[model samples]
Target: MPRRGGPPEVNAGSMADIAFLLLIFFLVTTTIETDAGLDRMLPPIEPPDQDVVIKQKNIFTVNINKNGQLLVEEELLDLRDLRARAVEFLDNGGDGTCNYCRGGKDASSSDNPTKAIISLKNDRETKYATYITVQNELVGAYNELRNREAQRLYGRNFTEMEAEFLNPETPASIRDDLKDKVKAVQDLFPQKLSEAETSASN
Candidate 1:
């Protein structure tokens, strides 16, 4: 009998090409997720020329320990109450210069919006999440006041005004008008937050 033909040789030449094609497909179709963090622009470093004095009442102190405990104005405080306390401190209008202010006008709080400052200090081992939350609450306080002022002045929300100002399709004249309004709102409640060096634990 004629010798049986050897088993047909299998072709392995295209395997590498197939793998390459799959790799390319996955590379092209895959999506990458990114973590979101605070949107803050750091100020340029400047040498201090001389000591600057700030009134005690104008400064709102917030301290955070490694255990995520909050000490606001020398008192232990819960996270949920931070925003309201910040708002009260910033909008106190103690100096009577802010004509549109509807605050309690407490003499022990901030003298005016212009001079108000929120000073935040955290322990070196503090949790990042806790720090971020505290920052959010403080910023939210500013937003709340700005929104109130925007509504009273322009019959529109501050965020709405900012959105219109930033919209690319808005007409030049209208955008300019929105720009002024947004600036006015920002001037009324300028953000003046100071982040200090983390304190070392004992």
Candidate 2:
């Protein structure tokens, strides 16, 4: 009897397993995409063991509204003068002995500039641009302070070379030193300014 020749039957049962294995292999080997978010330092969640009282003497308040109006210590101030006033507040009562003290030849006196609190308040309808502008001004104030401190430290004005030296590409030790100096000043300024003024007429 001539048996009808038929192609050898291929086993399809293992094909599913093979496909699954390949899928899993690729899943394991492939790089997963993750969202890169904003880089910011967050406060610690754990409560501190010791109670610390923050003094408000050196605190500086800055308020902004939906209309982009600026206020410093309940006084309306122009954006152009923001940096100057911040420096002035920090430099007040200069004896060259206090950490927050300014207006002296000593470098360390003007270095840290004690704590400053910036109270940002805006209406629900405030534009993002206005908020960002206010933030930029605050950052500008910090930079000015940093430059002034660097000048005081080097015992001379910030030259082009000194400015370049402050770059992060400099030596790790030097960069770290500058970073610490900036961090010291940056930490003093809080992101949220508490004393937000309402538009209601007094």
Candidate 3:
């Protein structure tokens, strides 16, 4: 036998090096990322804004149940129809100020694009997929409106306008002009979505 007693001497001269190498390998192969979240822009904090009363008629309500069913203004609708309906509701311009809006004038609908607010609510058990679907449709509606307005004003779509204004190669003077146009379009059809807290009770 090579060693009779004392449990034989172990080779530990490179143990620290081996451990360091293992640690380096782990650091290189393992990915460490921060927790990702749904990207959203929150409204600014203003003392008086909360107290400002929004007209009941100006708000369009969309609710989602635990069963993943969508209810728009208390009317159950298919997911496919949500986007178009949202567009119609937002572009209604019931108060008659939106010349660019091409919706049937309904007295009970949203007052105008600026005053219109799309309120979303969901139950505590609502599925994230369904909620995201509704949110996407609403965002798409806004995008469509902004695109139309941008086309009417700038002869291009809103996405193209964004590309142009954000391009580093664009001249400062041109960017300024585009910035004004974009701002005007945004003011005309600002994203006025209001999401309420998810209800815990059934």
Candidate 4:
């Protein structure tokens, strides 16, 4: 018949089944990747060493009531003056700089350099915005301190200078020295206010 039309051609029958099986197999066997969130330092739940008690006088407490009023050491203070007072306390008697000094810097010699423990207390009903504002102010204080330390260490205001100062032509050794100074200042930054202490205050 028309050249005996090659053995009544038959379509392959198993491909659809094979493809379905493969799709199921892949769905079962494929590994789903999960995102690991931001890195954080968590304190030990139980420690071999006994907990050291921090002195009350050494801790500077900032209180925020439901009304968003700010109090420093139980005294109502304007937010603007609060930061200045905190800095002054740290600067006084070189106590603030002690931590950095112990960590290997001369506190007595550095100007406007000190590290004081900041304790933040917020009422349960406090507005989230108010809490954030207080936090931002504290962070701003830290940044200001860092800038002052950088100026003291670098002997120049890098920000005020032109881009030429940061060019590739600049010596690597000089860049390294600046980096170290910046690190030193950063190391002195106050640790985040302890949530445990704050919760207890409320």
Q: Which has the greatest TM-score? A: 1
* Residue-wise C-alpha lDDT for candidate 3, range 1-202, written one tens digit per residue: 5747666788999999999999999999999886534557786786673577788878889999999998888899999999899988988978888788899878899878988999999999998788888888898899898998888877899978978998999999999989988888889889988999988845
Error of 3 at 40 (Å): 3.7
**CA deviation > 4 Å runs, candidate 4:** 1-50, 94-115, 156-179, 196-202
Instruction: Please give, for residues 80-173, the per-residue lDDT of candidate 4 as tens digits.
Output: 7866765554444344435333222323322323335677888888878777777777666656555565577666543322133356776787
Q: Judged by lDDT, which candidate is best?
A: 1
RMSD of each: 2.7, 9.1, 3.0, 10.4
TM-score, one value per model: 0.85, 0.52, 0.84, 0.54
Q: Which candidate would rank higher by TM-score, 1 or 3?
A: 1
In order, the Cα lDDT scores of the candidates are 0.92, 0.58, 0.87, 0.60
lDDT against true structure, model 3: 0.87
Task: TM-score for candidate 1, please give it.
Answer: 0.85
Which RMSD does model 3 reach against the true structure? 3.0
Model 1 residue runs over 4 Å out of place are: 1-10, 41-51
Q: What value does the lDDT take at residue 96 in candidate 1? A: 94
Model 4: lDDT to the true structure: 0.60
